[model samples]
Target: MPTVSMLDHLVLTVADLQATIRFYEDILGMRAVSFEPADGSTRWALSFGAQKINLHPADGPFDPKAALPAPGSADLCFLSDRDLDEWRQHLQAHEIRIEEGPVRRTGATGPILSLYLRDPDGNLIEVSNALHS
Candidate 1:
C-alpha cells in the first residue's frame, strides 16, 4: 500500500468564512491567501508554516465533504515555538480564554506542553510547545 507522509491541508466548514479568516489571521498570525479556481470562483485559505486550512462556507456545496461539517466539531493541535508562559500571556492579552492546560500531553512529536482554547466557531484548538530539546 502507498503511504502518505504529511498532511497538506484540511478544510473547515465555517458559518462565516470571513469571520473565520479574521480569527485565524489576526489571532493565530496565519496569513490568508486568496485563489481563483478554474471555474473563476474565489476561495480563501489560512497559511501557516508549511500547512494551511482551507475555508469553505458551511452552506456552500462541497464535494467529498464530511458527513457532519459543523464548525465547532474539530479538535486540532498546533505546534507553537513560544513557551507555555508566553502563550498564556498572549492569549490573555487577546482576551481569549484558556479552557485547559499548560499541562503535559503526548503530541505527534512526543511530549508537549499544551494550552487549549476555542475558536470563533467553538472548535477546540490546542497550541503546544515541544517539551523536548
Candidate 2:
C-alpha cells in the first residue's frame, strides 16, 4: 500500500473567486496563481509555503468535485511561526474579527496555540504555532 506523503492541494468552492483570492492574498499573504485546465477555463489557486488551495467557482464543477459542494464549509488550519500576540495584531490590522482565540490545541506536529477567524466566504481558518518550552 502506498502511504500518503503530503497534501498536495485542496479544492475550495467559492461564491466569489476574486473575493476569496483577495482575502487569502491580503490577509494571509498568499500568492494567487492562475492556470488553464484541460477544459481551457482559467482557474486560480492560492499558494503558500509548499501548499495550495485550488479555487473553483461554485457554479462550475471540475471533472471530480465534492459530492456536497458548498462554499464556506471548509475549516482549514495553517501553521505559522508568529506567536499569538503577533497574529492577533496582524488580524486586527486587516480589520478581521476573531471568532475564537489563542486556545490550546494539539496539531500534527505537537502542542500548538491556535487562533481562529473567518474568511470572506465564512470558511473557518485557524492559524497556529508550535508551543515550546
Best by lDDT: 2
Clashing pairs in 2: none
Which regions of candidate 2 fall more than 4 Å away from where they truly are?
A: none
* 8-122: candidate 2 lDDT, tens digit per residue: 9999999998899899998888999999988898889999998999998898867689999889999999988877798899899999999898898998878988999999888
lDDT of 1 at 112: 92
Per-prediction backbone clash count:
0, 0
Give candidate 2's error at residue 62 in angstroms: 1.7
Candidate 1 segments exceeding 4 Å error: none
TM-score of every model versus the real structure: 0.94, 0.94
TM-score (C-alpha, index-matched) for candidate 1: 0.94
**What is residue 68's positional error in candidate 1, in angstroms?**
1.9
TM-score for predicted model 2 compared with the true structure: 0.94
